[model samples]
Target: MGFLGAPVVGVDELVDRIDPRPVLESRTIHEGYVFDLVSETADLGEAGTVRREFLRHPGAVAILALDDEERLVVVQQYRHPVGAFDWEIPAGLLDVAGEPPQLAAARELGEEADLRAEQWDVLVDYWTTPGGNDEAIRVFLARGLSPVPEAERHEREDEELGMPTVWATLDNVQEAVLSGRLHNPSTCIGVLAACAARDRGWATLRPADAPWPEHPRRR
Candidate 1:
């Protein structure tokens, strides 16, 4: 506080808060199956009004499934935009009507890896790109893993067909992430968050059903 007579704010006080601006105008530029592009003009109080365009996402969930051996279950999926087969965690959009995020996470884990978990906790929630998209994603830590029955497994299609699933040590995943080998946002975030949570004995984790007020559907 001595620097320039400015008060020093506590670290805890830096928490993100809700302060939504009123939108003066909004228009959908293009609607896609996954997300929609929209333009908005918002009233910024004394700063005057501003117009911005962003993607209106439906939100998503990712699972950081850790096995008994401290290894993470990861998958390889081809992303056309990036022109690479990215290593990523099992994740899917929250598109289904009235489905809980946890349930959607379980469905994605089962569909992508044929796995199920007995315990679940929320690892982290974040916006993928706040400047240009409203894609809010929640990553969940899932343990006590088990395989889904063969007859009950989901059939893969499109980009998910023949996707490769790998089990790698957490340390190796961290190293790969640090080396820029894993480019998927969810994988990078989940891996790093899992490491941090482990260091704190996972006491900072939120309940699986914790509220997500930032989700578009919730708002």
Candidate 2:
């Protein structure tokens, strides 16, 4: 928590103070290809019962692949909802049931960047738009990268077919983040986390397989 500022309380005290609201009822409002819209009624005690709607996402993993030159691998693709070409790290949904998140990260790395990494670390985990979506994303820092063998390369399709892949220096990426040029949530978070981890001499990173008990997909 050094980079995040002072801690308010110890883990035990924080856990003891938690009084989670109980969900009285929940139902899927719409079933989509990647996610389902859910409406939930919860007992908020003093606030009384309330109803809310949100997307129940399957979760996702993003990879921040760094080459020996310290350039970060990125992709530019058009996102329909945003109606713009966004720069983002390699990422994909964790839709494969029972598959480990780290493995999903590796798959995205290969599919999006055509790269494989020998070293990996957990950079950060975050919920994208927590107020309306349960889309949790775990970002990984990958080093010692090499191109994926041509024999096992993944075929790009749809939006990925013409997407351009590029490498940017860490400093440039950080500048983009601060200058508001980068709007993709996972990419921005990953870049900032990687910079912090590097500044702290890489002590902030966790093992690639570290337990993520808070990730909703795991539960």
Among these predicted structures, which one has the highest lDDT?
A: 1
Across residues 130-157, which tens digit of lDDT does each residue of candidate 1 receive? 9999999999999999999999999999
- Residue range 1-219, candidate 2, lDDT tens digits: 455796676666754222447999999999999999999998999989999999999999999999878799999999999899999999999999889999999999999999999999999988888789878889999999999999999999999997999999988999999999999999999999999998999999999999876576465
The pairs that clash in candidate 2 are none
User: What TM-score does each of the candidates earn?
Assistant: 0.96, 0.91
Q: What is the lDDT of candidate 2?
A: 0.91
Residue 89 local lDDT, model 2: 97
What's the lDDT for all of these models? 0.94, 0.91
